[model samples]
Target: MSYPLRRRLWAAALILGFFVLWEVLCLALQVSDLILPRPSQILATLFSRMDVLWPHILQTLWTTMIGFALGVIVGVVIGALIGTSRIAYDTAYPLLIGFSSIPKVAVVPVLVLWFGAGPLPAVLTALAMCFFPIVVNIATGLASTEPELEDVLKSLGASKMDLLLNVGLPRTMPFFFASLKIAATFAFVGTVLAETVASNKGIGNVMMSASSNFDVPLVFAGLFILAFLGVALYVVFSLIETRFVGWANRKSDFAST
Candidate 1:
């Protein structure tokens, strides 16, 4: 009845409609389960494999959370340091850019070598995938503080630390939260990639094994589970952003509505 509820229904309907259309097309075209399994097949595979899937899902969730946690802490600290000082920013930004430029998949082998092919490598890979965006966003948000505001605060005898604590951190909150959504998705990618390359457990391994066995429907089900987690995490962060930093976005929400 209400607008928000109506919007949710519309979104759910659209997703359902897409799945229905996909199912119909797959059925009508006689698509093989090996090539592009119907949604129905994927769902059946998921339900059938729950006994095997649960442990893999748990392993994935545990590794991803650990990595994401580490990434957030390190990224926030480095970002704060860089964002608050031009010297720090100049020194670190290029290095961060260079490091982030490297494809994370390439680093899985090196991580596996060091960590010996278990959750550690997956955690580290997830950490590597996630931290960069957070660092960049936080640094940009902090550095973007208005010069006029900085001058005013300075004229009033506010020290750099004081200004940063009072203004810069709060201003960067939105950027930090925004980056979390992106980081969450990246965390899963890193974890899965690592697991596929080296790990014995997790959804990545399940998917990889399924592929080798030509269980395409099972592979798709594994992918769906990962995607579901990513979407769930993104939603959680979005809700958090709206909850804690909603004040910062009050005007924007009003305008959009």
Candidate 2:
């Protein structure tokens, strides 16, 4: 088998082993389903209630995507500013750092108070959760551009915009994509946090409702759904990264082999 196939097989085996162990432990210890439902039970709940759960899943997915998209746009703009202009970096970086330092959960209430619940607060929370990483990565990528290369481009009469479009942004592709993977997960967290606190829709709200009724299996199922969505988005971005920046990973792939 090829190396990639072998790696995939190993991953599948590990996941299967984990579920098998979990099932065995639950059975052997007579663990109460209320505390930690067996994987089998969770799967059953997921499939059985999927009809009811579908709409909430869509809500959460939509909210997360909107937030993540907005985060990317804002992050790129701010990062470009910080990376390209020393004055912006000096003026804005500290404030950005302070904002990112605030717990996203804490901000969710303020958002809900201002926006009054529903998808808007969730979307904004996800946006807040994801903004910092992309900003940092983009700024780092732009800042890392070689000075010698910049001088050569300038000597060739390249305008600042030309240098940014042709060289700076291209050099930032790898970092930007890396940040996307991280930001995707954060976006989901932010959405869920807001949903649980203020909204009546989405997986987070579903989980909250389930927990209130002591439906542990359904709660776990919601968690599984979130995990699945997060992984799906991560894989999508990974494929896009490979398509765009496979060249960047060539060295690392070779070294790993």
Please tell me which predicted candidate would have the highest lDDT against the true structure: 2
TM-score of 1: 0.93
Error of 1 at 185 (Å): 1.0
C-alpha TM-scores of all predictions: 0.93, 0.96
How do the residues 1-257 of candidate 1 rate in per-residue lDDT, one tens digit apiece?
A: 99999999999999999999999999999999889999988999899989989999999998999999999999999999998888999998899999999999999999877879899999999999999999999999998999999899999999988998899999999999999999988998999999999989999999999999998999999989998998998999999988778777777665454
> What tens digits encode model 2's per-residue C-alpha lDDT throughout 1-257?
99989999999999999999999999999999999999999999999999999999999999999999999999999999999999999999999999999998999889988999799999999999998999999999999989999999999999999999999999999999999999999999999999999999999999999999999999999999998999999999998988788878776674543
The root-mean-square deviation over C-alpha atoms between each candidate and the true structure, in angstroms, is 2.5, 2.5
Worst 10 residues of 1 by lDDT: 248-257
Off by over 4 Å in 2: 251-257
Off-target runs (Cα >4 Å) in candidate 1 are 1-6, 251-257
Error of 1 at 182 (Å): 0.7
CA shift of 103, model 1, Å: 0.5
lDDT for model 2 comes to 0.95
